[model samples]
Target: MWLPPSPGQIPFQQGIEAVSERFIGAPFIDNALGEGPGSHDPDPTFRLDAFDCTTFIETVWAMSLAPEPKEHWTDHLQKIRYLNGEIAFTQRLHFISLDWMPYHEKRGAIVDVTRDPGLPLAESLTTIDRKAWYSKMHPAKLREFESRFPADKPIPAFMHYLTFQELLDNPQGLNRLRQELQKGVLLANFIRPNWDTIKYIGTRIDVSHQGFLILKGDRIILRHASAVRGRVGDEDFVEYMKAYKEHATLKGIQLVRFKSL
Candidate 1:
């Protein structure tokens, strides 16, 4: 069973530790892709027995905020997953950099600390064309989903993201990234560069993955649900970044830190 720190525990690093301890050997399940989008109702659905990367982090964050997390997990999940705590499918925070992070930051659930380390970062905008990629649903299902929105609802044009190449080019930014890693912040990996048109169209987000940062003795570790490893696991943060750098398609990373309201 999943367990996490009581509400009084510190957020971020402490919350991460609690989640890490509780789910050390949990299996990675692609539950999000399998179960997340097809539903017609606005209710929040979650599976604790298994998790994908996003669900794992979301669950831990919700649990960390409550004295008895299991008792209130759904309520917290609803708040974190949807805008204004509404249960509508369209209200869900789907895009990591564009939707999820920005929503939470605005609500005081977290802070975008990507530029806080004084990194010389460059920004760029990307469009999430849901129709081009997310239109895979059967026409009937697509119609059902779209019916929830007003006919005049305008699609979002773009969102800002920091480039990994910029960090690679700037020694100062690299150093700052390392410094932030040492402090144990939440990180999201942007895999836009590697995603082909078909792949990008399906997901409609620049950020492909996310995880928590931790310091164990002198080593920095990324504690997350590893799709590659097929389970929840921890790895050296720098080594993971090295692997990401080697991938031709991975663009780079963005950082965020949890802050209590």
Candidate 2:
């Protein structure tokens, strides 16, 4: 999973704007981070040349959390990526609703704003059995994760989000959506298909993708590293979300924003 040769470390930057500007054109590479320096994939703890959806948000948020982010981005990433900043593959926040979001929420790092709009929302019923999932992985992976998987065991997670039609039916919700998007430093996570989008993988999941919500003037934008577009770019929030109508893969939107540190 390692890249050919990463460039030098990013010069210390203070806020998300500085870090965001530098990663605007990064390529979207899946499994971009590996258990480097000790485990699984060889990729380093951080890099700007490439990012998957979650890593882009993690890296940018890491930079945004500190006064002099360059010095602390590494450890910040660990805090965001793993529960209690435990540096282990098993402790990594693998599931968004179950592990990532709740861990951050408990620590006062981010506040889930999915319910802030007061839209007609519904809770997703997802059965997450990572212990079973790890058991099915290659023997070596099962050994590392099976017994210790799903560190927080109550994780057949249920999350609230605004479905496409629900967003349309509530004009008040539509208006609130616009207002929420305009608030910068926002993170938008896309909940997955209502049915079985990942049944082939033998895992059930609620969240599938994420990006930063960026508003430029009156235009609301989702600044994300797009795998379909092959690079990081700004996409019109409404036009991009139109995929919800075209494909069932996009079930809903969950908004999260960082708290002042």
Best lDDT among the predictions, by candidate number: 2
TM-score of 1: 0.77
Worst 10 residues of 2 by lDDT: 2-11
Q: What is the per-residue lDDT of model 1 for residues 1-261, given as tens digits with 9 covering 90 to 100?
A: 444334444243346576555676678877452224556642237655567888888877776665564466567777887878776556677667667877887888887776676755545355555444436533434554466643523244333344555555576655666677676556554546324455534544456777787766656678889899988888886677666665665656667787652
Per-candidate TM equals 0.77, 0.86
Each prediction's Cα lDDT score?
Answer: 0.63, 0.72
How many Å off is the CA of 214 in candidate 2?
1.6
All candidates: CA RMSD (Å):
4.5, 3.6
**Structure candidate 1, residue pairs in collision:** 133-201, 194-249
Write one digit per residue (lDDT tens) for candidate 2, span 1-261: 323223233434455655666677778998688557757556777776789998888887777665464466688787778767777777778778778888888888789988887777877878776665555543457666746743534346778887866765566756787787666557888887344634555567778889887766766677888889987778887776666655656777788878843
The positional error of residue 188 in candidate 2, measured at the CA in angstroms, is 0.9
Q: In lDDT terms, how accurate is model 2? A: 0.72
* Top-TM-score structure, candidate number: 2
